[model samples]
Target: MDVCHYDVQVKTAIKEQKAEAIVLTDDGMNLTAFWTRLLCGCGTDGRFEPVYVMENIIPLFDKSFNYEIVERESWFYGEYLQAFYTPEANKIVIRDDVYERALAGVALDVITIAHEVVHCIQSIVMRFLNAMQCVEFKTAICSNDSNEMQQHELQTDRITSLVLSPDSLTEGKTDNEILQQYFINPLIQFVCGLIKTAGKNLLEALNDTNCYNEVKEVERCAV
Candidate 1:
């Protein structure tokens, strides 16, 4: 198993989802604002509507995933918990308190929701690999005790940080420059590159009729 290749694929999937979300907006004028809300949830003073933000995200998953957003009083644990993604139900649950906080101008909830969205993408990739009968790779991803899972979680955190702090990557800095200035781990570049590729593939797969059934098969396995 080429672990580097797998990491790249996962990261690409994430980037593809983000790109898809960006294009969903009308006139593409809100690109920066959309990312801002997603990353930092800053400056949402009547300027950023959560509904529109969600609308952009929900479509990134193909129909087979049955992605739904529900606001509940408590999801899983309790009030301290903000949100979670359930693979079996194919649902993303946002705690009412978190929603309220966002409504009251809290940016952290936005980042939390985005993090859960990354989990959704992870679930999708895992299911896709399972459907393709890549047993070894699937096992690597699904095994709870594996170091792969820990690294994946860390990678997700890094990607989330980069997305929220776009300035680090886009402020006339090369990937190397950003890495040094931000003190980002060297492994993150590989992960980030893979995410970019996976995102492109995911977007293509979402639209291709031939891949539709394969995606549906993955969804079936999840249930």
Candidate 2:
């Protein structure tokens, strides 16, 4: 069985080996913050400018994030698959139709890019963690590890919304205002609100600027 799917094994590894215990829980917040700061440098300037999808996000993955966008037929994944990140190839593959809709500013398609961006972020951090010798942490992030794939996916979705539409940045705006301002899909905004209600601490931690230590540490060690 894939140990990545089993939180018990990860916990046992952390306990027995005394690892720093960086996994997909609180570290997810840190990962999101680090990437957001790296991409936009918005909050650090004290202005907290909102990130633009077309101008900021697309170019982010294209250039700074070190991932190439490859477009193919929509049915390449046998239909219904819009986009995905391939860690080995370091590419974000988008279906042709989805790519066109994103270019056309379709809300859902545009947000799809954000989703894969999180996947790319997770893959980078996970690889670095593995190199740092968190051997048990390796399989949990495997794309083929069906055990916790859904959990990873859910966290990725939530983190995508947090990056695109942080409550700290968009405070006092109604749902409609957020949608227009952030270019976020309506469903994503709604789910973000629901999660904001369910987990106040997680949201606050992710919005914290100091929470990027994991990413900074990874960069430092990689050099």
Candidate 3:
């Protein structure tokens, strides 16, 4: 499918609760709730403070994969590669420079680690749940088709953002504060702001066939 249809399908999946495996929460829950579950697993106490994902969450979940740092020349992407998850080995390899920056508390680099962790979840948890068989989930994880690849990258980025700084958790927090506290990218924070602002209307539109049809028409025209 083209990007537009792919987008509509994603919205439809989210609305239908077909994305629960990836969201890690029930339908209609805010991103904060999703993050709570993802970060704390089943032992959450309702607080949404940032936690050490590698130390606390991953270990709690028994996903004790090693972080392997390698030279840039180790991958085809070279220096452009921040980090990547190897499903066969169940290990996440980080580029040397990215690892160094993450050690120094660089927000983006830390986010890169979280991004790879999400990739691990996709390969391990989601696959175990049989979610990989779904076309939407498959496309969002490892499809090679151009449209599917875009969806994959988009889903990874969205999951990373949701894990880092959920909308409800951003209350009264400035962009810089969110960056320091959540390691959220400025672009992700801006997009989260728009989504939070439009959330009510977006939910209404999803539930109203007429509104959904109008959105389709707009998408068609734009295409």
Please tell me which predicted candidate would have the highest lDDT against the true structure: 3
Per-residue CA lDDT of candidate 1, range 4-101, in tens? 56656654543333111111112111232223333334432224334334445445544544434445632334444466555556566677767667
Task: Give the TM-score of each candidate.
Answer: 0.43, 0.46, 0.46
Model 1: residues >4 Å from true position, as ranges? Answer: 1-53, 65-74, 122-139, 143-146, 174-223
- lDDT to native, each model: 0.48, 0.53, 0.53
Regions of candidate 2 where Cα sits further than 4 Å from its true position: 1-23, 34-38, 42-74, 123-145, 168-223
Order the candidates by lDDT, highest first: 3, 2, 1
Instruction: For candidate 3, report its TM-score.
Output: 0.46
Cα displacement (Å) at residue 15, model 1: 27
- Candidate 2: residue 151 lDDT (0-100): 61
Q: In candidate 2, residue 23 scores what lDDT? A: 35
User: How many Å off is the CA of 100 in candidate 1?
Assistant: 2.6
Global lDDT for candidate 1? 0.48
- Which of the two candidates, 1 or 3, achieves a greater lDDT against the reference? 3
